[model samples]
Target: MRKLARWHIWLGWLAAVPLLIWLGSGLFMAARPIEEVRGEALRRAAVPMPLSGLVLPREPVVATKLALVDQRGRPTWIVTDADGATGRYSARDGLPLGPVGAAEARELVAAAWNGTAALSALRRFPRDAPPGDLRQSRPSWQATFADGAHLYIDADSGAVLAVRTRWWRAYDLAWGLHIMDLQTREDSSNAFLWLFGTLALAMALLGAALLFRRRRTATGRRA
Candidate 1:
């Protein structure tokens, strides 16, 4: 029982570290509404897509999905084929438009950003090697603002992929700590996580046994 108590005490301290990380991260993530954390208001308001003189894709697209969107004051048709390949075309003339170039990517970010700080830098990330701030595997352009806000644009589709702030990066770190996967930040069932979780449960059981034993001893003394 004494050895059990000592083990429980040490294990409890170890468990407390991750539990506190989980608690703090949960509070920080929940402090603001999800939309605000995502910096939705920093984006320009959407004008109704003007497709009055609409023309469809000339080539036969085995389309799995399609969207009519406004691209830099022009109507664009974003097409996704059955094999999950995406393409962009002009809705006005059915002409092929993207794989977005750097200059156009700059224009796209400028038009989309409604924040006060001016754009400080623009960088590109390859499909295989992407910024940690971005969640997608596709190639992208990152427009960074003076305020530490980063807006990611799809290199192939010219779409706004994600908006991340400094706080979001902190949240991401917290998530990695909470999940015990600081490397990938996605693994929830790693060996370290399971081992620590088992230790925490054992500590709790040991604590309960100690409490029960003390209560019974006190009752017998009173009797």
Candidate 2:
């Protein structure tokens, strides 16, 4: 009985830290507005696609998903093939303008942002196995505003992909801690967490059993 109590205490203490971290981080995440963390409120609205003057290629471009996306108030055709190749072309003559550059990325974000914050930093990532934010569009630009807001623009399409704020960073950090992944902060499938969780559950059940035994003994003594 004493041995069981000791094991339960040890396991409970071991599990307490992670449980508290999970609770604290979850509370903080819930307190912050999701929109603010995602930086949606700071983004500029995409203008309507201008299809009136569009001159699409008569010779069909074999693509899986092709559509007109707003590019700095102009209509631009975003083409993606079955092989997952994407490009931005001039709607005027179907001329391939190629991927968007750093300048265009900045322009795209600035035009849409209603905030007075200036573009503080701009970086282009290659389209090959990029970071988590640019995983969908490998080659993308990360435009950081002076207000600590980051706008991810697809390099090929000149489209704003995602907006991230400092609040998001905090939330992301908390999530990483909760999942026990500090480096990439994404590996929730780790075995260590599972092992510790199981131990904690076992500890709780054993403790409950001990309490019930003690209560029954006290009742017998009183009677």
Candidate 3:
């Protein structure tokens, strides 16, 4: 009984060092703000996408082939088939175009074809009464363009519910750092985290083994 008690105490002490380190590190990591980490990561992950030319419409057809120019001014074509018919070699990488419903097709045209006109119409629409006003306002979602323009979407139907102008602010450098995991978003998904955990566990186990061996040796001597 004495030997067994001594062994347990020794094992626990051996495990104590690694156990302490693991607890301390985990507590520190958990204390960090997730939002700060996410913003920094977004900033670091930022990269410019190549600009493709705008697709211009040719006719008043429900759907038309859109003409586009690459960054180098080279022309490329994409079919904006809105008719919802599955026609081969139409556009979007030779995918079928057209045969879509009239209403959906119209919405697509309004969004892609008449970008400027759509913005103007949205601006002219009267603003909904604020919260607690006499008139009830419908809930909506919104997307902001790079040029400070906003396209309010219907939350339920995912439709372009409205369009308007709004403020725009770019993410700060810290956000980029967080996104990249360079400064803020600790590379928790990487092998390093796993390595650390494994090492900690191993150290704890090793300490326990040392304690057991010591107890066994002491017991044999007493016997």
Q: Identify the candidate with maximal lDDT.
A: 1
What local distance difference test score does each model get?
Answer: 0.87, 0.78, 0.38
Q: What range of 10 consecutive residues in model 1 has the weakest lDDT sum?
A: 44-53
Pairs that clash in candidate 1: none
Per-residue CA lDDT of candidate 1, range 2-80, in tens?
9888988998998898778777877887877777778888998876975567999887778989988888998888898
CA lDDT of 48 in candidate 3? 41
Pick the TM-score winner.
1
Model 3 residue 92 distance off true place after TM-score fit, in angstroms: 36
Error of 1 at 185 (Å): 0.9
After superposition, the stretches of candidate 1 with alpha carbons farther than 4 Å from their true spots are 50-52
Number of clashes recorded per candidate? 0, 3, 20
TM-score of 1: 0.90
Where does model 2 exceed 4 Å of error? 50-60, 128-137
lDDT of 3 by residue, 1-223 (tens): 4655555566566656546654664554455555432223221222243444333334334555443322112232333356422121222233323333434433432443223323232211222632111122433333334444545433222223333332111222222222333333435455544554565566566657777888999999999
Q: Over the stretch 1-223, how does candidate 2's per-residue lDDT look in tens digits?
A: 8888889899888888878888898898898788877777788666666467788744468988877876776677788889877877777778777677767777887776766788888898887756564336467888878988778888877867777778888888888888887777878888877877787789889899899989999999999
In candidate 3, stretches whose alpha carbon ends up further than 4 angstroms from where it belongs are 1-22, 25-187
Candidate 3 lowest-lDDT run of ten: 167-176
